[model samples]
Target: MTPPNTGRRSEASRRAVLTAALDLLQEVEYAKISIEGLASRAGVGKQTIYRWWPSKGAVIFDAFLMLSEGAEGGPVQLPDTGDLAADLTEVLRATVTELNEPRYEQPMRALATEIAHDPELAAIYAERLDGPLREAKRQRLRRAQRAGQLAEDLDLDVAVDLIWGPLFQRWLHRSGPLTTEYADRLVATALDGLRPRR
Candidate 1:
């Protein structure tokens, strides 16, 4: 059936599709979800879904983005403080929390596992989920450097890698506990390393 053109019902149908997609994504692996399945679950026609979203991946990713959005429908973002260490600590601590939350953790793992083999899915994940957060951190670091909190000549790409690498490694390998304390420690170590030698 074609989705109703009325504004209220259209919004409702969109929410249903989004909610159903997220529900299925959390329950099943990424590769197992189909647009037909989502439409059935959402109680909308496949044509309606196609009209709104380009593909199953787009719908699933949109659902994931919605599920992970911060307050006011924004992505999880880094905060800028004059103190670089404090800002990093705040951001990484929140990251630890999200990584520890099962609702997000499981879905993230499912996406990561599949995207490794599918470049299209990987690109979507990179652009939608990871890109904004990385850019925010880069902007924050640049601001800090200008404020004299970091070495003027620091390489931002390496600095970002240093800041986020270990955390992602641990998250990927499950080699150690991901805790706020660890996040704080990571920030302190990076800050110490970034300081110019006296």
Candidate 2:
């Protein structure tokens, strides 16, 4: 029960809608982004957006997902270099780049601001953003622990937070420059403290 071109059209529409939603997020605040605006800018009907996504937050979250997953590669994943420090550094370095991208900055800020004000919106963002990102990090850390790259007694949850918390603070707070060097230093410091002594 599908036309030959239906899938193509749907794919195109999804891209268009995501594009328009992000564009509008930059133009307006997160609270202002609406399905109606996305539909208009995407050149699709409101029903089209509704058919694909249950809510506007879901649509914007999808856009964020697309950006994080990236276009060149299928999706971003934690690195595995057998050196846990190196892997974490590379992943964090890439995250710094993603955070600094001009296209992502405005929209992410809008989302953060919106989430700060709306608990429901915050839940949606948590599910869409943290759900994937945190879980991936947790898995990687567990693997590193099993490989003897980390302390056997270390709490994985605490380890994940220790790795991500500072960078996220710097990002959300605009504390200072987010550079590869900074990420590397963080990884080194954490590794020195976390890796079990021989």
Clashes of each: 0, 0
User: Which ranges of candidate 2 are over 4 A from the true structure?
Assistant: 5-7, 69-77, 110-129, 194-198
Compute the lDDT of residue 83 as modeled in candidate 2: 83
* Model 2 lDDT tens row, 49-98: 99988767667667876775654354336878788888888888988998
lDDT of 2: 0.82
- Scored by CA lDDT, what does every candidate get? 0.80, 0.82
Indicate the residue-level lDDT of 48 in model 1.
Answer: 91
For model 1, what is the alpha-carbon lDDT of residue 51? 96
Best-fitting candidate, measured by lDDT? Answer: 2
What lDDT does candidate 2 reach at residue 28? 80
TM-score of each: 0.78, 0.76
